[model samples]
Target: MRIAVTGGTGFVGQALVSALLARGDEVWIISRKTAQDRTGQERLHYATWQQLEQNPALLEGTDCIVNLAGESINQRWSAKAKARILNSRTDAAARIAKLVGALRQKPATVVNASGISIYGTSDTKTFDESSPAHINDFLGSVVEQWEESARTIPAERLVLVRVSLVLGNRGGAFPLMSLPYRLFGGGRVGSGRQWMPWIHIEDMTRVLLFCIDNRDIAGPVNACAPQPVTTDQFGRAIGKAMRRPHWFPVPAFLLRTLLGEMSSLLLQGQRVLPAKLQQGGFDFRYPTIESAMENLVGKSSKPSV
Candidate 1:
């Protein structure tokens, strides 16, 4: 199969590309800048989405398309940064919709990235594809709009993965989230009652592939683990994995002062569970926090003290 991935240079994208290649699929990456020739492999190709839109041949014979393009949401949300966050996702989704509309042969499926943040900060309620979106904050609004844009694309199967916090060694949310813990400066943010939905990076990549291969799955699927931990529990788990002492507690006001509105990402969380994936018979590689963290940090290394 030929898969075209937008934002294929990102952390998740890089891993996904490697996974697809291992399974013998041709991968094409769409990025604003030219992709570096690190692999020196012809199976992987790169081009800009604008160029691809101008020339439909770029998408021709493409079996599937994954739209993962978007700006990072971790920074302080200044007015300009907020607009960039919204526009980057919506605009990219719109572009993909247009490309699909113009394609002489539409792809069989389109898997676009959404987020569990669409549910906003909530209690332990488990949300599935049928759950109504919570549009109370900027992150929720961004995800709502992002998914709406992808809905415009007419395809046989449209999948919106409301992904949880992905834990990996290199990038995405893990490095930043675990940094304080590694430094033995970890603690629960705010009340520590908020639920944290997380998935191992490997599981996330596999779930994407599962969605691509399975035609029956569509709509908003929770790309998270079965077990959702509270913020306090998450801190302790990381500390346990790193051999660090989870003692301190960061006050909400301090976090708010430091991160501005972006502090909500840390202060509040959702207990997202992969109900659809489990129901669909997908087995996770690392279902528990302990195993997941061990895989990430390695077994031989001592936990930070």
Candidate 2:
């Protein structure tokens, strides 16, 4: 299969690209980098957004296009940072939509990244793909706009992967998250009751592929494990996996002071279920928080996160 990916250099995108290339698939990376066509014995290619704007035919034969390009929301949520977060996501989706609209041969499928935050934070509520989006906070609002833009993409099948916290030892949040445990400081953050819907990086990649291959799957699909854990249980599992004590309790006020509005992501969260994935018979390799942490931490002495 020939696939085009935006943000192919990012953490998740790099992993996804590697997986695709391993299976002998042709991969076109659409980025801000210089354009490069397929070289001899190379299935990977590159095309800049500027080049694509000039010639939409660059990605004409691509079988699928995955839109994962967006500004990282990992920074301090300043006014400017917030604007970047929202605009970057919406802009990326709009660009993909425009590119698809200009395409002489539209891709069979488009897998756009969405967020579980669109369901809003909840202490006593469970959400699924069937649940309506609730824009209750900054992240929620950003994702709402993000998905709205993604909806405009011209594809036969559009799968909006409502990604949750993707946990991996080498990338994403797992490395830093496990740092405290490695230092024997694993503890509760904020109120510790916030729901944490997570999926292993491997499972995340599979979910994306499943969405692409499955003709019956469309619309919003939560890319999360069936067994979602609370923040407190999450820390405990990490501590146990690392042979550290989960005793320290970071106060909510400290997190609020330190992270400002961004702290709400840690202090409050929604319990999400991968209902669509489950109904479609998608099997998760790491179904539980315990299993996910063990696989992420138990491999190396000091794994690079």
Q: lDDT by residue for model 2 over 159-263, one digit each (tens)?
A: 999999998766777788889888888799988889999998889988988987899999999999999999999999988877889998999999899889988
**TM-scores vs. true structure, each candidate:** 0.96, 0.96
Off by over 4 Å in 1: 301-305
lDDT, candidate 1, 1-305, per-residue tens: 99999988888888899899889999999988766768887798888866786787887889999988999987889999999999999998998888888988899999999999887677767666677888889999999999988899888899999988888877887888889987889988799998888998889999999999998899989998898888898888888888898888999999999999999888888777788899899999889888888777645633221
Which pairs clash in the backbone of model 2?
A: 170-305
lDDT of each: 0.87, 0.89
**What is the RMSD, in Å, between candidate 1 and the native fold over all Cα?**
2.5
Q: What's the lDDT for residue 63 in model 2? A: 92
Clash counts per candidate, in order, are 5, 1
